[model samples]
Target: MSNRLKTGLILLTIAFLLGCILVQMFTQTLKSEITTLPDGYHNVLIRVPTTFEFCGEQVPLYDEEVKESFDKELYINVFRHSSTSLIIKRSEKFFPIIEQILREEEVPEDMKYIAVIESGLENVRSFAGADGYWQFMEETAKEFDLEISKEVDERFHIEKSTRAACKYLKRSYKKFGNWTLVAASYNRGMGGMNAALRNQNAISYYDVALNNETARYIYRALAFKEIMQHPEKYGFVIPKELRYPPVKYRKIPLDTTINDISALAVKYGMSYKTLKYHNPWLLMNKLTFDKKDLKNKKEYILLVPQNPPMPHSNVLAQESLQMQKMLDSILHEEDTVIDIQDVK
Candidate 1:
């Protein structure tokens, strides 16, 4: 081969190797950039049944706009896995009680989901200073006969607060003449909703354009209802045991002052913490009652844990007593004596 041709070939080989190295480096840089990019939000598609009735109103879940809104909520809630999971778990403990009250009040059972949207089924204080599972403000709670005080806040009391919510919804329904408006009024006060209705001259909640929070309120409620009703559809598979069970207790009437809750707890064979666990409405270590006043009789209701014999309590108690007697007999036997000091 000619020297010039060999030299050209050698130069070509060097260029090819350099080009290959450059390409490899560029590919890695591109891969890293792709990996580092923030994850894109994926829109989840939820298949809701055609139409669901809430409080005698037909909500078209399958309608295009309704489905889109529902899908948006499903995606948002599903991606917010932690919050949704906790809500689901807490619902197990709270829903039964709320359901019973709603049934008694003749309110729609679906209205129970309203609590989930309001506070995620938690007794949380809002940035606006609203408190409790129902998120009742001081005035509203008082208006509903919920005791809101430093010493006693019944907003934290699930049963009382739920009953208060029922009253509010019923009144809202009477005023608005529709369930959707009633639900929306929960977010925007009855006055606010009425004002909106007058300003917009619209009877329907959907027609009224509202501020951001109030606008999203009804949609969030319906979304919560959708996801919670079929949690499996949202990739939430909580074990039955992971769900909290409703605690059982007997309501004992105690007109007298409870000076020592710890001693009271011990008398019931439970820890003081346990007593408070079941009755969180008890604000202080000691309950004060006006002994002289007749009205004080209704002031106190002590919830004592029903120590109903466990399924195995009888067997275990009997075995423990037998074992104690055997040990006592052995220790107190006069025939059993030992030398004090053998070495001496």
Candidate 2:
């Protein structure tokens, strides 16, 4: 090659390298703050907002360390597309019920997101024996009026579990008066949180030196709230109809002992599996009731689904809606007795 040609090639390569360096520098500068939404839709990157809050409590985003921690959390969730997408979809079905309960109890709407972080809004039993969407243990569940006998475990009951959670949140708020700390207290017990505050000599949750799980708790809840409210911005593109719609069920008043739940299921024109799916609070194969029990508890709410439940689904939810609409017989009247052999 000629010397002149070699020099020209080197100059071109240098220009290209400089351009790449400048681009990388510009992108790094933009990572901390988004002055405007970036162009593009699918597979685009996003940064955490400069200003953030939880239930109206301001995050100290101005501090570099705090901002970086916020950045880490947002990235962890926003990039976890599949799981986060499931959460976005599940929220549509569950949040309506949770929000209504929170509103009725005068709790902040943000508390609904805690359920998302707790069990992904599902009836999950934790390794520690914490069960349901709110993750309450046996004592705690009973302490909050959740019936957890051999026949019933209200921890798996959605509305009842949420009401119990609201009761816990209210008690926490009475002690801390800060919703964020109250959120942290859900993971770090109320006493643990109080001790941390005293030991660290800090008034705010941000100031406390906490264990990894407790420290990450509020941030995870905030991240869930942020992505859920602004799904598109976080690159979650679930359609409105594609999100899981709220479950529908017919409420049956059960006053007598259910000697055999399988028979009870058949009497309702539902499979045994379908019966338990809807009435997760029904803990046993047989529910024994004494006549005396009815004096104080006049009736129990048996949630028999109008159609089978679609847990963690959008397409199945739509299909279930169609099933509910089909012309069908009321296979047995409410008073019909199920055969004992069906139970056997």
Candidate 3:
């Protein structure tokens, strides 16, 4: 090989090696830096306060079994950093809407935490066919006057479902005359809780022995409330901008059936995905009305994002510019020192 070619090859190989070493050092340095504990942090010993309450009723934290159950929920949630962080973040966005409904219905404000446990503030369907943030079964949702059909399921609509939940909770409160039992009744059906109370000859939820899942229901809700009320104490540290903000939207009424939700979205100057993000209640591409619905003049609400995500073209352009800037910085860093010995 010519001398010039040999020299170029040597520099190229040395530069590649230097880049690898520098990248590794940078990565290791970052790894060693103090960072948020994403997997939960705890000391070897932990103590929980003896007193706790759900709604206006007190938890039997003084009892050993109750303490054990409360501890399990509290520690498990604290250590589940990522999942709990999402709950912490989403509550800020959704809790205000729910709180308002609770006030209107005269339901205790703490009842809003039930949604956190039901679906983690998400529009999710359960394996058992329960849907929405409130996780209402089809029959229960319909009973509470929430529309659930193939084209639409209002159980997925945050505001609508919360109102439905409040309706159900108010009915439950009337039956039990205690908000605590009403909260439990939401998990184990009102009938089931009544049966447990009757069978055990106990008047309150604490005195009745129930299945594990139902038993843990109130405790989990309580755990989430504690964390939400005091997130810093539980180790969640969300920054102002990093926190998910409440969504603002325009709710357009739909008296007539929409042949296709996607086409409707285009009319509103948004993509179908953006439409779905704002209106999760829309389960299908089309919204059709039968004679019964048309005659009844059924009304559905379609939410359009007020601040739709940056248009697709803009997002791509911004991403490209960011990539170019990063590439330029890396090239500049390499330009300043191609000598391998200088890196050391």
Best by TM-score: 3
* TM-score against native, each model: 0.75, 0.76, 0.77
Cα lDDT, model 2, residue 299: 72
lDDT of each: 0.81, 0.86, 0.85
Q: What order do you get sorting by lDDT, best first? A: 2, 3, 1
Quote model 2's TM-score: 0.76
Model 1, total clashes: 0
Can you write out model 2's per-residue Cα lDDT over 266-343, one digit (the tens) per residue? 777776778897788888888877868877785788888787633434467778877766523343444465778988
TM-score rank, highest first?
A: 3, 2, 1
Going through the candidates in the order shown, the clash numbers are 0, 0, 0
Model 1: per-residue Cα lDDT over 183-258, one tens digit each: 8889888999999999999887767889988887777777788788888777778887998767678887766677
Task: Using TM-score as the measure, name the better of candidate 2 and candidate 3.
Answer: 3
lDDT of 3 by residue, 88-182 (tens): 88887898899998898888999988999999998888999998999999998899889877778899988889999998998988899998899
User: In model 3, where do residues sit more than 4 Å from their true spots?
Assistant: 1-46, 313-344
Ten contiguous residues with the weakest lDDT in model 2: 326-335
Query: lDDT score of model 3?
Result: 0.85
TM-score of 1: 0.75
Task: Evaluate residue 61 in candidate 2 and report its C-alpha lDDT on the 0 to 100 scale.
Answer: 80
